[model samples]
Target: MRLSMPWFVRLAVIVVFATGLQAAPAPALAGSDQPPGMIAAVVARVRDSVMRIVVVHPPEAPPGEKTMAKAGEGHPVTRIGSGFVIDPDGLVATNRHVVENATAIFVATPDGGRFRAEIVGMPHKADIALLRIHTGYKLPAIKWGNSDALRPGDTVIAIGSPFGFDNTVTAGIVSSVNRDIMETPFDDYIQTDAAINHGNSGGPLFNINGEVVGMNSVLYAPGTYSGSVGLGFAIPSNDLRFVLSRLEEYGQVRAGMLPFRTQSVTAMMAEAIGSPAPGGALIAALGPRGDEMNGLIQPGDVIRTFNGEVVTDPRDLARKAARAPIGSTVRLGICRSGTIMAVNVPILAYDPHPQPIQEPGPPPKMLGLQFSAAEGSDGTIRGVAVSAIDPTGSAADSGLQTGDIILRVQQQPISTPEQARAALQARAAAKQPYAAVLVERNEKRTWIPVALPGE
Candidate 1:
């Protein structure tokens, strides 16, 4: 028989075992020298609104079999992601892909309370979705920050569940602003090195002041395992606000169109056009439906401003046009033939499948380059192919080489030498200083501003 141990001895043994098993103290946070407790304070302010999203999909059917499952009868395919509440009534914002094709959705808050969620609306083009849950009590909402005010190197915080770890906090600076990932036409991602991963999609990217400035969405990883490699992208809160407003008003986001294709002005093109610097968007082509503004605005015109806002590049014009109110008249400041002109055009709903306009007549040869009809592989005339270039002339000085096909001059198509000559003569008659020429070289197309002779 063994003797029983004293109460003090038993207590001492329990304490020793518990102390030995205790987890090692967490490491101090890196990358910042904030006063003690600053991070904890910020986290406390917004952590309650951060949430984890769970999506359940119906089971897959057998090969080539149209197997349909009864209510809740199929095997559940589960997906996990993150989201944040933007309204006290249980409205949540998340990535569209997270809830796409989901049979059931659920939201889990920080306090371990879970609720069923329903999709309010999702704009596929923007990759943003809104969800609503019926929480008995009002939930905390995050405050929106001005994304436009963000600059490169500004401190930012990313909050989400990475690899199923709930409420993981990562801090990094803004790697870049106005990043275009090319995933969609409305791409204007805020890039940061905030350790975003697969499950981080739809989580809030906070500014230093605990305000939501972006929504973490995409990670740039190119291997079998998709993990953050210090390159992550987020949707700007400004754009998100616009999408949310449209979703609330019309149940869908509406994109307005300018009905024209544009290119960025190069320094050479600007000098040729008599502009002081390389700025503004050069109109390349207009859609057939854009003919309503044919007389007011023409191809080859440089758009300098839209609705009193300066447009420094093609992307800027596109973004402004997309955000414009449909059917509202807007003013455009255009530079045509080195002269400034104003035109008002009514914005129309964007046409996803716009009809192509008829190609214009042949371009004129103001520069010392001879052009002939180019033959395509199918023996069809594609454009005016360069036959000869005068070595001492403007064409040679502007970098036009032999075999460079003259596609268009001032946005007018060219097929024969005579048409090109006529187009040049028209510019000469108008006393224009130069002509913007579109040339195809080695299958690549570019715009070259050829200075007019005797300008």
Candidate 2:
């Protein structure tokens, strides 16, 4: 039931994944034209490794609850996604979002076998999940591809369950690489024209040789549109491989961190910094450890290179730092006061389960509202009480009622009423037909889709 509305709270469509190179010319098969065995051969080779996942959650499970009530608490909510076999011992790979909230998971293969699957491991930050099923015999697994070698216009093939249609194949070229849709601090996504739909979230995006190049993950479309608009994104296989390795070995993914908070240098900033062109990552802010690095790499210093490699931007530095070998000191080329210099900084592994920082929470920020959407000066809406519901309105039709309180819209806390209004308005203006809403009623919370009114 949780079709993740990630960076697309503005554009309202569900996502799908796909990629494949055009097949080489050969003898025509039964079907007909196009190239001989292009897409067909690739699909035939790897389709069996693809998986169909059926997840059952407690109907009353709050949205995004990682662990839910064991199945059969109430009417179970069934949601479907896709995955692929990664190991012959029944290990599977999938998007983290697919099974994050699942109470019960079922995996089906092309050979007519269905088995219960359990979460083997998953990274805290990346959208990658690993599952393991106990199959008596060896299961077919996919061959890994080099995502770093992918280029714009390279072909790709995707296999998944779109709308519960299992093993569905779609192909498209790489639209671009290293896309930053802001999903995470490490946001290098492979943009593709593959038809990734609502149910294609965790499937495999294959190259022409039947090797898995990426995992179908996110998509872009009009808010009201139900189909992919040839704009889909996938987690690159190299990143996926790294996360999987960390998850299996460490029980979590580890990322390397430099001491200071940074942002990309802009043209104006470059001019002020006396640079020839706009480039390099600029240290904009500092944390505690950043204070330590600040002495050597002060604020306003542009990181021109990392370990002798040219640093393109903030994201490039992030990726390089995250994937850098642990305990290794890397050289940072920095420009400060218009002078270039080098400093060796030890890569720091981020603590995944550190004690929660005691936030500025002495006086809990509150907004006045048992009915009206009263919000604090900081723009956080406490609990917007639904004073009344129009019987014929979309909320009412979605089973919302008077006295119900709105908790979040699209996984984000409604900041101010105006921000909430504008976000919904933008989705409506973009012709997005529905808004995913979280509501509390009778002291319980649940997610529901509220249809936005037509223009």
Best by lDDT: 1
Q: What shift in Å separates residue 232 of candidate 1 from its native position after superposition?
A: 0.2
lDDT of 1: 0.73
Q: In candidate 1, what are the lDDT values of residues 66-107, reduced to their tens digit?
A: 645332233334567889998998999987777776555668
lDDT: worst 10-residue window of model 2: 360-369
In candidate 2, position 429 carries an lDDT of 72
Candidate 2, residues 1-455: lDDT per residue as tens digits?
Answer: 12345434221112334465343332222123337666797788889999987664444545776433322233335577899998999888988777765545668788756666777676656778888888789999999999989988788887898877789888878889999887776778898887777888899999888899999987787765656777888989999888887767765676787867778788998989875568889888776776545377777889999999998888888888988876688999989878888998888776546332111112111111124674545998665765543322323234455556777878678745566566556766777656777878776889876656544
Cα lDDT for residue 81, candidate 2:
84
RMSD of 1: 30.7
CA lDDT scores, all candidates in order: 0.73, 0.71
